[model samples]
Target: MDEVLTCENSRVKFFPIMMYAMVMGMSGLTIMYQKAALWLGFTDMIGHLLMMVSTTLFVVISLIYLSKYIKYTPMVKKEFSHPIRLNFFAAISISMLMLAIIYKEVNVNVASMFWYTGTVLHFYLTMYTISFWINNNQELDHSNPAWFIPVVGNVLVPVGGVGFASQGVLMYFFSCGIFFWVILFAILLNRIIFHHQLAVKFMPTMFILIAPPAVGFLAYYKMYGVIDVFATMLFNLALFFTLLVAFMYKNFIKIKFFISWWAFVFPLAAMSISAMLMYHETKDVILLSLSYVMVGVTTMVISVVMYQTVSHVLKGEICVQE
Candidate 1:
């Protein structure tokens, strides 16, 4: 009994970096509902409730992960060096970025702090992650949509950085994100078509493929305040991927739950928000209906995943060695 208790206590040492994805999903949902409130005339109560819950989760998870880092420093370093886990380090910064956006309206000063910190951290990780990819001899099958988390995260800066940072600064990150996205996307496509399918545990990460164009559309519109031909292309590309993923839903539903299932939440949140943005800009009735549908699906998915995560944690199914 003592040994079993000791093992249970040790589980915290294996806390994975990708766990930050929870904050990303929750924050994405918070932002999604907030946008729905503005665009669809829904009560902001749901948005506020989600914000409070996500913020609390962020704080609690941060503390727990920090403890893991402090006590299991070598294990943390090993995960950092692992080709796959390295990409997820950016989830930490992405969580901060999402929080920054959520708080921008509630408190600009707080939001500005999160934006600056998240921007600087993500930028460093981008350089390091890309450099790691260039320098290392990595396997082709190692490439997954999680690769997008590090460098392509540059696209996220502009959405929250508009008034807080200079236009040139925002433009620099946006360009890097977009340029890298296409290059990495081609590589990911080749892997999917030529290489073996992603492992069952990672299949859910396919959802990440939806984020770039959807988020790019949002960031671009935020920077320019206009919907031009290029913006239309980005939004359309996102919609295409969204449809593709939805078509694959049968395959996804058969897979067992992994924390990677959280991957399903945030990209749909981006697409849902993108749909709302398109409606806000075009006021097209179809776009409004799409936004409604996306919002409903995203909200339901996040709620379900959150419940599954809690269930798994209680079962001690998460944070185990692979």
Candidate 2:
């Protein structure tokens, strides 16, 4: 009886991890399809397909995890279930906008805004849900150092996710929210630095959470000159910051492994490419292109690093996933 109970407990414990992997894998597929659409110039059709896939994934994952794995806080229970409802609304909006984009049948600006707004709604809901869980339940046991690594690291995921998705709306607000978000991120970083001895300063996973939203912001900045001056400056500063962090990691950690490193490189490259695209529109071609080239090289190196880490884990070697 005790053995059976232990087995059941193990299965329950693994559920969240499995859910995380599944959701993240779906995200990767969405990104891959988006890239494919861009390269193929079948943006109208493929973009719609990607949007559909993303919408489906978001709804399915949210329902499955929230219904089963989530242990809600009083705040979540009391506060209106706005996040969940908003996600459902956004999924619907995305489906409609995707159809419009495919048919080229709607007012361009309206369609663009729908896409932007829907994305923001989706990720903001995600961040809120994840944060509620983290604050309420996940951090109750701080004695486990291994848990802190992923938990703290993943907090950035929510932050980045929100920032990335809201970039379009953020630019309209003249980068107002973005400035505050960055400040908040810095504060969080300082807390992690002081409280946690983990040297995440050079960890590639940081970019995994950082780059996507930065790219989103850049995408909007390039698409519309909403806040070019501010966004450009911010992006360049981010690149410098990334380089500095990478340098520090190289100097201190002798990172001889790589399992989840690809996560970092993809987002970093997304930001770099977005920045270059924005700069190209502004005629700052040379520097931006150079930045993109440098980012591409670093991306490949990090991919190799991630591959090594994954290989080690599979062989029952390093237990980095914990």
Instruction: Tell me how many residue pairs clash in candidate 2.
Output: 6
User: What do the candidate models score in CA lDDT, each in turn?
Assistant: 0.92, 0.41
Q: Candidate 2: TM-score?
A: 0.50
lDDT accuracy of residue 174 in candidate 2: 32
Scored against the true structure, residue 92 in model 2 reaches a CA lDDT of: 32
Name every residue pair that clashes in candidate 1.
none
Best by TM-score: 1
Tens digit of per-residue lDDT, candidate 1, span 245-307:
999989798899998999999999999999999999999999999999999999889878988
Q: In candidate 2, which residue pairs get closer than 3 Å at backbone N, Cα or C atoms, i.e. clash? A: 164-213, 258-305, 258-306, 258-309, 259-309, 259-310
> In order, how many clashes per candidate?
0, 6
User: How many residue-pair clashes does candidate 1 contain?
Assistant: 0
